[model samples]
Structure formats: C-alpha cells, structure tokens
Target: MEQMTATGVSPKEVRQRADDAGMSILRLDPLNTWSRVWLPDNMDDAYIATVDTRQDRVFALCAELGCRSISLNATFPRGSMSIEAIIEDYAKICAASAFDLDCSLEFIPLWGGRPLAMAWQIVQGAGASNGGLVFDTRHFVRGKSDLADLRTIPGDKIHCVQLNDGPLVLPDGVTTKDDRYDRKFPGDRQFPNVEIVRILSETGGLNQVGAEVFSPMLKDMSAKHVDFARLSGRGAQDSHGNVRKDLFFTRTGSHRPLRFGDGTIHPCLWS
Candidate 1:
C-alpha cells in the first residue's frame, strides 16, 4: 500500500496518469487462490470462512483502489459450486462498486479439459455480455483453440488476454492451468509467445495484455523495471511495453513477462 501512496498515487491518480499517458484502460489483478490444493480437507470449514473474508477484502480493495476491472483466478472444484452460482456471487461482489467493473473469468483447464469455445458460449448464454474470458495465450493453446475459434466470440466477448509462450505441448497433459499460468514474461524461453501475440493482434485491443510472466528470476536484476522511454518514438511508450520484444529473448530467460493493456477491443472484427 505504501508503494501505491508514496507516489501520490490512488485509483483516481492511476486513471489520470493513464489518460495523460494515452491509455484508456487500467489492468487490475485479483489474487490467485490455488493454494487451497495443499490444505487438508478437514480444514475446509475454517478455510472457507477465511477465504470468504479475504475474498470480500479483495473486492473492497479493488474498488477502493479505483480498479474498474479485475481478472479472477478462481478455479473451484467442479461440484463445489456451479458456474451459475459462481457468476451470480461474482456479479454481486463486483457490483458492490457503483461503477460497472468488468468481471472476467480466468479459465483454467487445470481441473478438466473444459473447452474455451464452450466456456465463452456459456458466458454468452448466461447473459454475461459485460463479462468475457481472460484469454491467456498459453491457456488458449492448452485449451487447444484455433484462432478461428476466436472469431465466434463477439470481439468484445474476450475480456482480456495474458501473453506468454511455452513448449508446443497439447493442453491435455497439463494437470492444472496454474502451472502454465505462473510463468515468466512473453519472450522467455519455454513458450510460443510470438504466435500468441499474433492472435492478440488479430483480436486487437483487449482490456490488457498482461505481460505477467513471473519475475522470480529477475528478482535481483538491476534492470528489474523496464525503461519504457528508451523505446519511445511515435509510440511515446504507453504504460505497457509496446517494445514488441519479438521472441528473441524467448529462447533466453526474461526476468518478467511483458504486460500490455488498453480499454477497448476492436468491435469491427465481429461485424
């Protein structure tokens, strides 16, 4: 929180900065809760209460932080709750804000091989026109979806996308989606980032292209933070890296995955 306040930053400040910097959207991350996997089944009741409280805190914090949208990393046990129930609860939580915050689902095929194509259909069927899937390049790959499948979605149906690369393995073998998700930035070795970027380009402006490749390796790099200015030109360097780091470093390791975002998606694609 101190980091947020020290720079005279607040949610409102973030909006102003984004506007001044020529950005239309701010990307907000929700904390992931995959740790539940390790907890003993006997502790379910206690953790449920605890998790619920934390979940409330998270929603309140996002609103308080002035975040207009959030990427949810929730993966529930299939029978634990139904998607309808989850969406209803999620809507109620996000609606806590007087502002309409887009509620996007982080589809993890970790639990089972649920189709990305099918999930989007369900979201659309559920009348969640305001919501969409958080499309991670690797996740989509693992989901084994072709770019053509994306055309079926109303361009706006894809809420956001996370860009990254990985081995050309099919999604069937991957046990949990989180393992693939918690990877380093786009051009890092061990992933198909370039092709994924192409897909995102075809789709056009999403809520954000979170270059959220984990930075554990670069935790100690003096260049931990990137210099967006050095790469600026007609670009003027937006908040996210337009550096367009081709898969050059993809064979090498990057400290962090690059991140990108903009508020609107190209509507004409659907038309």
Candidate 2:
C-alpha cells in the first residue's frame, strides 16, 4: 500500500483508467481498519500516518469506484493485537461502514495472521455477515495449512482467491521478506496450483482468480506488464479444469498482476 501510493498515480487517475478500460473495481486493500480503533503500542507516528492515509484514501476511492470489497491483513506482527481486540475492532469497522462493503481477512504466514486457523477464528468471533476470508495460495502453503480445511469454510464466505506458486523449498536462512520477493510464476515450481483452482471451483462462490506474483525480478523488466498477462493466462489455463480460464481475467480490485481485457495490468498489491 505504501509503495502503491508512491507510484505517483492519483486515485482519480486510476479510477478514470479503469472506467476508460471498462474495468470494475471489486476490492480495496489493507484499509488499515485497525487504525480506526487501535494500533500496537510500539508503532511510531509514521506507521500511524501510513495506516490512516491508506485507509482514508482507499475508502473514499472505493466509494467513488463502486468497489465494495476490501481486503485486510495484519498491519503489524503477530501478538501485536489480541484476537478479541481484533474482532472487536473489525466489528466496529463493519458496523461503522453500515455494511456497504464486504471485507475479507487475508492470512500471511509470517505476519500477524500467521495461520489460517487463527484468521478463521477472528472471522467466526466477529460474526459479521459481510466478513469473510481471502485465500492466497502462497499464504496457505507457507502457513502449512491443510487444503482440506478449506472445505469446512462456507464458500459464500470466501470473498476472494489468489493463485501463485513458489519454490519447493524455502531458501536457507530466508525471512518472510526474502520469501515474498522470490516468488515463481504459477506451476513454474511445485505448488499444486491446478488442484487449488479445482478445489475453489468445487467450493463455489468464486467470482475471479487473482494472479499475484510479487517478484522483484519482474519489477525490473521493461515488458513486465506483458509478462504478467502472458503468465496469468498460462497459469490460468494450466490451472483451470472445468472452470473457464476467462473467469480469471475479469475486472477486480486490489489483487496483484491483474490483467484486464484490454491489456492493462496492475503490477503488485502490497501493503
């Protein structure tokens, strides 16, 4: 989110581009809902500013674009906030929004939402009708979560799905920071990308599949946009079973490496 805003592109420009290209914004990001209620005692004023700015601007932009889905992950590290406090904060945010949008909690293994189970717990406790999960393949695998557990979740509660592949083994002495920038394209490694797509299909309620590739290598390429679209299409075709690969190309919000029908691409979605 910090870097996203630093792209020097205005929200109004993004809005106009999406409108011009006939794209529909389906989600917003890391809205810093926590800033609305509380933050860890250790966070500094800069962190507060980043949180508030991302939230306020994204919220207003979503309203302008009619994007009703917001994706949130942990702003700080795990144990920075208690489960009870997080749920309470989420409930407050949801209530304050007057249920205008659907919100999903994305679990990142090394981040605050360290595992899938804990994220599910927060959603269950919050008990907000519009509350749900944003399942990302990298997070799911990194957290060492069971794919079978996904069956337990009501498909209707799955607000979004992201697909990506990573190395079969993490690099020695690697941190989450290292893991993030070193991702491989889908099926370029050992991730069960096809199975995940099939499972989400069976689970139902899928509106689109997000192709998220957060590679620093890709960022340096002059033709990275073209690569993202080509890889997204290849990945989707390789992964899609009975599901149509075209479903993955539909307009959405706040997902990475998102390719539009007219060839515009959203590079990365980081917060």
Candidate 3:
C-alpha cells in the first residue's frame, strides 16, 4: 500500500486498520517527502539534518507496520544533478536503511531515472544489498527501455513490479504527464506488458506483482466500489487466451501463483 494512503494517521493506527481488514502492507509506494527534497543542490548541513530526521520517522513507521520494503523515485528535473551524484545519494540512502528494509528506486522517463538501464546502473553502483529497482511496466513501455538491458539485471535486484498498460504510441497532443494519470488495465494489449513480465519472470524477478492503475475514472469511486476482482480477472488473461485462476488480487501473508501467457507459474505477493 502507498504510505500516502494513511496521511495524517499514525503508523500504529495504520497497522491496526490493515489488521482489521485482513491485509498486510508489503511495502509503501514512493517515500515521497524526503526524496523530493534530497537533491544535489540542497545537501547542506541543515538539509542533511532535516533529511535524517525524516528518514528516522519513515523507518520507524515501516518498522511499526511490518513493511519490509519502500519504493523511492528521483523525480527531479534533468540537470538538477549528475547521474553520478544521484547514484551517490541513492547509495547513502540504501546503506542507511540496509539494516531495516529494502529501498527500491523507480525510474521515470521524465525524471533523472530513465530507460531502465540507468536505474539499474544506479542500483548496481549503490552496491547496497538492500538497494533494488521498482519495475513499472508503464514507464518501461513509454520510455522505450531496451530489452537487452532488462535481461542483464539479476532477479534479486528487482524488488517490485508495478503492472499497468498504456498505448504503445502516445496520441497526438497528449503529453506524458497527461498520459500518466490515464492508464489501462494490465491485459489491454495496448502495451507490451506481457513481454516485459515474461522477461522479468525468466530472470526470477517476479517476486511481487501489483496492479497500479492511476485513472481519473477511478477517482470519484470509493474503495469498496472499485472492482479489484475484475481487475485481477483481466490481469489473469494472457495474449493466447489462456486464463489463470491463481492470479487473484490478495493482500500480503496470502501467497498466489501468477501464471503468464508463457505458462510459467511464479510465486507472487500482491501489494
């Protein structure tokens, strides 16, 4: 679950809520506050102190909630920092949290991390055992990530796989920011989600798979009204018309086998 989902609520309360609902939080999405401010230009003594404090709070919350991983992204604009500097900062962050949990860096085409390979480079450069990558299919498709580079990453380096689909080619006048909020379900076939999933599975990186749809259409609907079962059902269908019953939406602690079009079954933990 996204940590922002429990904004203004205490970590204890958040854990209690999840316990009541029979769900476990596998990880938190995008440790937002600290990442946004952790830039090359802002690394002064005061800023470092502030960042440390924030990290303490976030780590404490994760420990309280029993979440073992947290996703992070570098959304800073291009030229704000060099790739080397970004790698250094990410390494420090990962090393700092290595004792507690995993810190996965997500690559965004519009931001510093792009094309999947560079994200892997940062993770590899970090050299922290707990440092990993968050493989989001939408960004992979939209950014035109190289398949060859995707194959090079080992299974353990990939911490999470966020599954969603979008058009292979963006429509006219639609900026990436505009397209980001409007994404299709996993089995839409508009994006090559299957091929990417297949590659990740072959490399043994399909540990955690979750449907992360950010659509304007879903904004007005309440959580209970959203049909997760339908989402899981569509996600279970493959290009060859094969459907797998094991690929249902489930919370943490409940394991499920996700079967892709290639007829390979991988143990998956849904977030």
Which candidate ranks first by TM-score, i.e. highest? 3
Q: What is the TM-score of each candidate against the true structure?
A: 0.60, 0.74, 0.75
The runs of at least 3 residues in candidate 1 whose Cα sits more than 4 Å from the true structure, single-residue gaps closed, are: 1-25, 31-56, 79-97, 112-114, 170-182, 228-271
- lDDT per residue (tens digit) for residues 1-271 in model 2: 3454589876666777878866666787667554334343445798667655445566676787678888876665667777888788777666656438887888877667767777888888989988888888898888887777776777777787776777656879986656876776555566666566656766773534555777876666566555555444433332331234344333333434334345544223321
**By lDDT, is 2 or 3 better?**
3
Instruction: Give candidate 3 regions above 4 Å deviation.
Output: 1-8, 32-53, 219-271
Q: Which has the better TM-score: candidate 2, or candidate 3?
A: 3
Model 2: lowest-lDDT 10 consecutive positions: 234-243
lDDT of each: 0.50, 0.65, 0.67
Ranking by TM-score: 3, 2, 1
Local error of candidate 3 at 102, Å?
Answer: 0.4
The digit string of per-residue lDDT tens for model 1 on 1-271 reads 3246667776567667767866554445553442233222333475454343244555555666566666665555444656566556545544443457676766655532145765665466546435667777666666676767765565566667666555656356555333543454455455566555555455553445444444354454343134331231213123453323221122333333333332121110000
lDDT of 3 at 18: 88
**Global Cα lDDT for candidate 2:** 0.65
- Identify the runs in model 2 with alpha carbons over 4 angstroms from their true place: 1-10, 33-56, 220-271
